[model samples]
Target: MKIATYNVNGVNGRLPVLLRWLAEAQPDVVCLQELKAPDDKFPEQAIREAGYQAIWHGQKSWNGVAILSRIGAIHETMRGLPDDPTDQQSRYIEAAVNGILIAALYLPNGNPKPGPKFDYKLRWFDRLIDHAETLATSGLPAILAGDFNVVPTERDVYKPERWMDDALFAPEARAAYFRLLEQGWTDALRTCHPTETIYTFWDYFRNAYGRNAGLRLDHILLSPALAERLKEAQVDAQVRGWEKTSDHAPVWVRLRN
Candidate 1:
């Protein structure tokens, strides 16, 4: 089975690019973030036509997430993180598909730091860390894949010095991410290619992609059971160069049955 994750930026606006990639990649399961559309606005029919059944959590012009599967029925488990009743951002969705427990998330992009947004980002990370601990030890074949909004290490980003003040690169956020990994979840890409400079996102400005300046924000984490089955992990870098494409390119892993 092939599983993938992508931050689409906007589902409807980039539907064409998405469908084309779906056709090309043909992943059995996909986790998408940043729908930037309300639930009613998600292009369900289009995705259905593309041979996928999906469950999505969407918001108006902002954070959203979804899971698409072509292998079997998607048994949706939850729509948002537990323990946050007041929080209403559509950033998470989880489901069981083809014997795998999977989650899709769009972690907050806290910018202009040392403020409410940054604080919220850390708070959210705390919640995710707690919840992920449960999943990590669940003994189920599971995956946590999405745009984490975290530059986990200096190697994960292009210029560590320039992004020091940024929320995504903040020590606290990176620590939280590392803590999550320590819970027995394997970072599939990094595990597969530890020393390689792999990136999943590029800035729209400064000709970032052309200059090979990017960040490995999107990720696919596997539980111990699935980690042992990881056969290949890669980024479809060329997709980012497509016309009107998302800033994030799809990252995927091939798993042995």
Candidate 2:
């Protein structure tokens, strides 16, 4: 089965690009982030017509997440990350599709470091880590796929030194990512292409995509059961060049059924 994750930036604005990609890539399951729409505003009909069933948690003009399944009904397991009752952002969603448990997340961007946003980001990571430990030991085929808003290592960014002070590349954030891996979830793309400087996102400014100046932000992490079945992984980098596309490209993994 092929599963993929994409941060569309705005689902309505980029509906055309998304539909076009769906027709071309045809992943069995897809996790989408940054819907930037209200619950009633989601283009459910259009997505349904594209041969997939979807469950989405949407908020007005910002953070949202969804899961789409082409093969079977997507049994929703959770709508938001646990342990944050005051937190209302629609950032995490989980479901079961085709016998695999999938968690789709849009982690906090935490830009302009040394501030409240950055603190929130770290706190969020801690919450995610706490829950992930449970998932890792659930003994079910599972995958955590989405835009993590993090650069796990020096190789994950185009210029490590230049980004050292940035929230996404901060030592604390990278350490949190390493802690997740310690829970036994394998970084699918990195594990498949260990030494390659693979990237999934590029800034629209400064001709970043053309210059191949990018960051590996989107990820697909596999639990032990699913990791054992991991057959292939890749970033559809060319998708970033599409007209009116999001800064992020699609990242996917294939597992042996």
Candidate 1 lDDT over 30-72, as tens digits, reads 9999999999999999999999999999999999999999999
lDDT string for model 2 (41-106, tens) is 999999999999999999999999999998999999998889989999899999989889999999
Model 1: which ten-residue window has the lowest total lDDT? 221-230
Clashing pairs in 2: none
Off by over 4 Å in 2: none
Give the clash total for candidate 2. Answer: 0
What is the lDDT for 230 in model 2? Answer: 91
Candidate 2 Cα lDDT to native: 0.94
Q: After superposition, how far is residue 78 of candidate 1 from its true place, in Å?
A: 1.0
Using all chains and alpha carbons, the TM-scores for the candidates as numbered come to 0.99, 0.99
**Cα deviation in Å at residue 1, candidate 1?**
0.4
